[model samples]
Target chain A: MHIVICIKQVPDSAQIRVHPVTNTIMRQGVPTIINPYDLFALEEALRLRDAYGGEVTVLTMGPPMAEDALRKALGYGADRAVLLTDRYFAGSDTLATSFALSQAIAKVGETYGAPDIVFAGKQTIDGDTAQVGPGIAKRLDLLQLTYVAKIASIDLAAREIKVERRSEGGTQMLKSRLPCLITMLEGTNEIRRGSIEDALGAARSGVLKWSAADAGIEDLTRCGLRGSPTVVKRVFAPAARAEKAVQIDTAEKTLRDTADELMAAIFTRQPALEHELAFNSGA
Target chain B: MSTVNRETPRPAAGRAGIKKELPDHFKDYRHVWVFIELERGHVHSVSFELLGEGRKLADKLEVQLAGVVLGPPGEAIGNAIAEAFAYGADIVYIVEAPLLADYRNEPYTKAMTDLVATHKPEILLLGATTLGRDLAGSVATTLQTGLTADCTELDVDTDGSLAATRPTFGGSLLCTIYTLNYRPQMATVRPRVMPMPQRADKPVGRVIQHKLSITEDEIVTKVLGFLPDSQSATANLAYADVVVAGGLGLGAAENLQLVKNLARAIGAEYGCSRPLVQKGWVSADRQIGQTGKTIRPKLYIAAGISGAIQHRVGVEGADLIVAINADPNAPIFDFAHLGIVTDAIRFLPALTEAFTRRLSPHNRDKLAS
Candidate 1:
């Protein structure tokens, strides 16, 4: 059985700074890390490989520096890595991104085998859409099990998997057959550090790089920026409202006195609040 | 509570601003359609929310609001139609079949897209749930239409176009997208973001039974069976009237207990910032932010939260917001109703004491007796 883990290289949000003039993200010199969520996906896939005796392959589509992420995947016990990068792939949305990734996974199938399970993070911190997992599951015709809080069981022989799914009000235990895409929720598992031998093997291993044509995508028009429909016409910082709170100064007063003053001032500004408070003070 | 009549698609406007004058070809597109996402016999609430929102959009455009429900026949599909109208829909289109049961990308996608092709809608909206996101992506891809996910704002422009605004690039910035050239503008909004409409006493919507041309063999996937949640985590988050959510404040792992103590004292639920889960101090289910579960409790106490735009989008639904932080200039104060320029770790205990004194053992014992 072959397991595939899809990851992205995103700028560390803590290190990211916005360009005040252009109102655009300043990626310059900001270090990139494998999406924090994706690390869990990689570790989960490695755990499956260790238990099931299968090979794990890491896949990513990004700039050349993205290969660094794939190598890191190898250091984490993945058997192989593939990098799908091209100039034409720039400015791709989630839809276009899933297409490129699905094509790359298909190419992997030819070189290796059809993946028994494809894993991805719940979402990338950069996009925060969580759509790519479903998109890839759709394009590849794989069963999508999203928001999986735990992999309760996986029966490789039966090609079946059972997991707990998170929902608005409760968790749902969902069971589905294999050849599916499962997007693991974050904090479900801790990522393991690579062993010295694994790190050495990863440093020496070659990363497979593919252009659009190499990934078996026949229509260049349906790939990257062209395939994306929703165009971001513009992006700007949210304007801060030019208003201040009515400061209730009570430095020298007691809590009860301050509370009374607050109620008075609040009533002066919003008489309606007083009515609601009175009505709701006790039902 | 019968289904409403199936009306013809509303006629498209001709020679409008920009929009390329609505090509002589597309002047035929019309109808306000809600996608009733069916799971087992039950339906998701976002479906109702979309119906409520779709009703408003339909009224503004002066078109019939219809719900497109697909499920297995004799599996309570009609009940969903009544539920749709109870929430505020005027029409229902049902395509019932065995293949459509137990949401699979292939069957549900085929059923929905086929309905839209046979009967076109000017606008379509779905809930941004896991199933909704999965099914919407497939349906939109099959229909070759534009879909905006997690939209915070939805309205009609002067040109009668769906103006959709969503947080883009991790919610740091917002971008409004317009399906200027496309018909049946598609969008999905998360649950709890929109207010629930009052259910009508008598739902008088016309139900138009739809034709399911596809069959079981045509659809490849099977439900097999569903594993019910062994441990439910979602219910407590949604129904809690009072919630104490900690932001980056509360300092470290040990400090999160202060929030928990306050919550315990006030009989409220406790949650934390996204970074807390990232830090392994709390479970992801306890995180309260855009990426995490959204909460719309009546009273929300945000301690030490800096109120980043991403986190702000998640908690905007809280009715009464009280922000406590060491920094007076924190963004949380801008939107918070009650602002305190004090340390949360210290102020939290004090507020907890205040609330405890106000509604303590004596009051609780009296009420219980």
Candidate 2:
């Protein structure tokens, strides 16, 4: 089995902030991390490779700096990494992104082997669109499954796989054919720490770099801002509330006394809540 | 696949092109359409919520608002259409087929995409549920149009373009997107983000029936079974009156017990911030944030939550929000109605005990008398 996983490099959301005056993102000092959600997909791909005796290749599309994210995925036990970077790829929305990635995955198939499964994070923190995986699946004509909680089983001979797909309030047991695309849900598995040997091998392994032409993208108009239909008109910070939170002074009161006072304050503001709670509690 | 039109000239020189003209092929697109999502013989509330929003946009554009209903050939489809009329649809499009009985990507995508091609709509809205997201993504790709997911606000701008506002950059800022050059501007809004509209006693409006041309053998994927969550395990966070959530501020996973204790005592739903879900302390279903569930409880008690922008947007709709955290400088304090700077590990227990004692039968009976 050959498994391909798509990962992205995104700014650490914890340190991201919006400028109060200009309403623009403050990206000056923010460190980039392998979109935390992608780690789950990477870990799941590695686990499948370990169990099935195959190789896992990680893929990403970004600037030259994104090679760092690919190397990090290699350190987590991937066999190879491929980076698709080009000036024409800038400003590509989710639609253009899926086009570039599907083309690159085809290129990977020619050089290495055909991938049985294509994996990606459910969504990206920066884009938060969750549209690219499905777009890629549609372009590739693969069976697409998003929000997969668990892989129940895979029968390579029959070319079938079963998974528990997470839904609104329950799960759906779905069966599909191989060469499918999956967007793994977060927290499904913990990413393993690289061993000393693994880290040393990852440091020496070079990532295969590809440009738009190298990846078999013939249409320049379809690779960048020209291909993106959705345009961001304006970005701004949400208006601040005129009133700040009313602080409850815990300086001079015991914990018990503060709890009592807090309850009093709540009931004073919303009198209907007391009766509603009483009704629900059967008090 | 080239979108460049040789016949139509580009906008005149020098000025920035913020409002691009609609392409000639897409010029006739009119009405606002909402896909009414029905699964397991029941219509999801998010569909009605989108209709409510769709009504406002339709009125703004002075166009007809329609609900697109696709389901098995049965009374469930009829019932869903009737409910769509009650929720404020000027028209309802029905596509009945056994293939669409359960949502497989193949048939439903074909039905909706074909419907859009036949009768062009300027805007298409869908619920951000599992089925809706699955179907919307495929349909948008098939139509080669732009789609925005989990939008918080939707409106028609002065140029008559759909302005879809959603949080971006991990919810730190809000951006409004426009599909100016595409037909049928599409978007998905999650449950509880919009208020459920009041149902009026209105008859079903004009019905337009479409055909589904796919068969079972054509679909590559099949639904093997359905596993419904146990009644005890399901948390109704979206519609709960009161919610109690924990965050990473809780030192360890075991500390989540404090949050559950308070929730049980107050008859509230329990949840956690996004990081708690990522840390494996709680399931993804119980996560409250941009990527998880957006809740609008009447009262929200946030313990040990630092209230990042992602988590804040999810619970900000609550009427009364009280935040308890050890750090006084936590961002949660900025929007919470009541802020208490203290250790949640110690304060949660005290709050639970106080609510228990105050709401006991003995105290209620005495106060009533």
Candidate 3:
């Protein structure tokens, strides 16, 4: 019943702001968080570890400073933390990322047996790509159950897991084999605050840092930008629509008059809306 | 433009023109393709939406716009082709298969990538649906090409590069990417992001069918059964004409009722921010934010939502965006068409009563008379 949760350190979006003059992001002074979504995955993994007799290991790939994210994961009651960091891995896209993470998972397995379940957040708020978990599954050849809302049950003895997968409309009761990767959706569970002991242990505990060489990777090409097929040539803000919406003068008009005037204006533009309103009243 | 060639050399570059050896195969790939998503016996609107966008990229490169559709026997098959034509597709490639009855990954990816290999399309687009994201990755991996997920903007630069832009850092920053060396500039956009094209009256298009060489046993994953959503719960929030969305400022679950009341008064649908759903105040379906749902309503009443870029992207399409918040400095006012600096709790009820008086059936009849 061992669990592995993949987390990435990303710039805190709340503090992020676009420069008024340049319209580019002002990234200075913006601190990084453990990808807000990954918190949910880490929390779910911790809960699973608490319920079942197993250890939870947190994994992240970033610059050396990302060790802080791993330490924070350790602080949240995780048994161990692994940081897969290297300069070569800097420009890796999702494809390259999954490749590196998969190699790291294999490395971790060599040290501490293959995890029964792997956890990832539904999608990273930074990338919002939502493909890495599936990518890892494809690379590791693990059954992927994404956008999982809840873990209905897991029978380790039977080697079967039942989970509620979030679909287009509702939740689907998906049953998959063990050693599956589940991307936990937001709002499924609340992240638990670590106790004094947990924080103390994390403050002292060391995070195992592994680069491409240390991860038992035979091919360096598949581990970085060279292996990554996708490239981000440039980044620019979305162009605001040319025509802006006109704001009607409602300074003197009362709320009632405003609503009435708005309705009349809308009806003038869309004559069918008036008919639809007429129909809503069973006229 | 010469530098652009240096940047994106296609077909593994010329043998004499400095070809950086790629993995065995994937040396020659060209043209552009779009995946017209057909699910549950009907074509998703996003497919047409992608075609409208795909038409631009194809014209930019002076290439043909081909749609790859995988579906069962039905009018849906023709509808996809017809809709693709209306949306400006030059060719609609169909892969009729019983294995693709439901939106499963294995067979559809096989059909799409096979078509790409046989008749290579340099760029491929798919609607960012549950089905699309699932299928795109596998296909991209199999083809050994780069794939960008959840792109908000796609354009072909003067150098004939597919520049895909998407929000990064949680909609706080935008990053434009190029599938520089990869063939088939792959991208997926959520439904409603691209404007729907007008339906052409005639079938101004061509069709080329592909052989789907896949069997049920070949794919390990199986859709054992299908469960349809109930009518009451199936709320298509994306295209709702009148939308009332609440945010963290709503305070609590009980306050969300005010938003619902206002929505009811205006004959609108109600939803909330991701925070509200996180707080367990609403279902995930009702969450309206960057990662939740992108909506384009005629009128949008946002109460308590301090419109972050993440939320703004989802609601930017609203014709009339009226934001109500307690904080006058809330970002929602920056983009909102109309704004009122007032407490959402108090203002929501007042707006509800105001809409009620104006939109009441009795008042409508009286005004008509």
Candidate 4:
């Protein structure tokens, strides 16, 4: 079995800040980490390879610096890493990104072997669209299983798999054929630490880098900004409300007394809500 | 790589990229349609919310607003269509089939995509629920169109393009996106982001029936069973009347107990910010944020949360927001209606005790009556 995991390097969103005056991202000193969600997919792929006796390859598309994320995946026990980077791929939206990636995956299959499965994070924190995985599945015509919580079983010989897919209001136990694309749910499992041997091996095994042409993308119009259908017209912070919170001072009041004051304030503002809460408290 | 000529097909250079003329095949695409989502014989409220939003867009575009309903052939489908009309749909498109009863992607995608191919609509809206997100991604990909998910705002620009605004870069900022060249621009908005429209006593609209082209044998995936979430962990935080959520300010996972105690005392749902879930202080289901859940409670009590833009967007719809944190400068205080600067670890227990006293059996019985 060959499992290909797609990963991305994104600025740590927790530390990302928008300039208050300029309305631009303050990215000068922000650290870049492997998108936290992608780690979940990478770990799941590693576990599958461990059980099924197959190779795991980590793939990413970004600037040359994104190769660091691929190397990190290599240290996590993936057998190979591939980076698809080029000047033409900048300003790509989810649609163009998936087009570049699907073609690269096809190239990877030809150079190595066709993968039985492709794994992607549910979504990137930066993009937060959750479209690329399904987009890839559609372009490749593969069965797409998203928000997957667990892999129940796999019949390698029959090329079948079963999974618990998270759905609205319930969990769906779904069975599908192999060669499918999966977007894994976060926190399903903790990522493991790399061993000394694994780190050393990762240092020795450099990533397989590919430009757009190398990835078999010939349509320049379809490679980046030109192919992206969605365009960002403007970006700005949400306007701040004029009224700030009415501060409940705790300096003089006792803790319990403070709570009482807060409750009184709430009732003063929304007397109807107090009754509404009582009517539905049973819920 | 082939170098392409830009002049022959250039339409106009807009803000993000070059906008192109709508292909001759797509020039006649008209109307704005909202997919009325039905799950387990019930219509999801988000679908109605989208209809309300779609009405605005339809009016802006000077086109008819329609509802697309796909479900099993039953009274539930009829009821959904009726509600759609009451909620402001000018027309209704129905696709009835047993295969669409439970929403397998293969058949539903084919049905919706086929409908789009046959009757072209300029804009398609859906709820960003589990089913909608799953279905929208596949359908958009199949149609080779653009889809914006979890949009907070939708409008028609001067050029008649759909301008979908959503929080991006982890909710640090809002960006407006346009599907400049794609027909039937698709977008999904989370529940409660748009206000529910007033339901009028209107008759059913013109219903157009479509067909599903696939059968069960053709679908590679099958739903073996569905297990509803247990009552204890239901964590219906999205629509709760009162919500008490903890954050990293609690300091330790054990301190989450204080949050729960307060929630129980007030008969409120409890949740935490995304970091707490990542820290395993709480499960992902109980996490509150853009990625976890978008909640619109009547009252929200946020303890130890700093009110990142991501968390703010989720809780902004609360009728009243009360933020408790040690830092008075926390962003939560900016939007919260009330603020208390105190350690949540210590304040929570005291608040729980206060509520316990205020809601004694005698007072509770009086209030109940």
Top DockQ model:
4
lDDT by residue (tens digit), candidate 3, B4-23: 00111123222123224443
**Candidate 4 ranges with C-alpha deviation above 4 Å:** A276-283, B1-17, B365-369
Q: lDDT score of model 2?
A: 0.86
The number of clashing residue pairs in model 1 is 10
lDDT values, one for every candidate: 0.74, 0.86, 0.76, 0.86
Angstrom error of the Cα, residue B352, model 2: value is: 2.4
Q: Write the per-residue lDDT of candidate 1 for residues B220-337, one digit (tens) a residue.
A: 4444445555455443665576788887777888998898887776567888877777778887768776676677877777889887666777777887677777898777777777
Across residues A49-97, which tens digit of lDDT does each residue of candidate 1 receive? Answer: 8887989989998888889888888898889999898877776666677
Clashing pairs in 3: A235-B176, B30-B122, B31-B121, B31-B122, B32-B121, B32-B122, B122-B184
Runs in model 2 with CA error above 4 Å? Answer: A20-22, B1-18, B326-329, B367-369
- Model no. 4, DockQ: 0.52
Q: Better model by lDDT, 2 or 3?
A: 2
Fraction of native A-B contacts kept, per candidate: 0.22, 0.61, 0.30, 0.62
Candidate order, DockQ descending:
4, 2, 3, 1
True contacts kept of 2: 0.61
Deviation in Å, model 4, residue B343 alpha carbon:
2.5
lDDT of 2 by residue, B92-158 (tens): 9989998777677778888999999999999999998878888888888888898988898999998
Worst 10 residues of 2 chain B by lDDT: B1-10
TM per prediction: 0.86, 0.94, 0.86, 0.95
As for DockQ, the candidate ahead, 2 or 3, is 2
Chain B alone vs. reference chain B, TM-score for every model: 0.89, 0.93, 0.90, 0.92
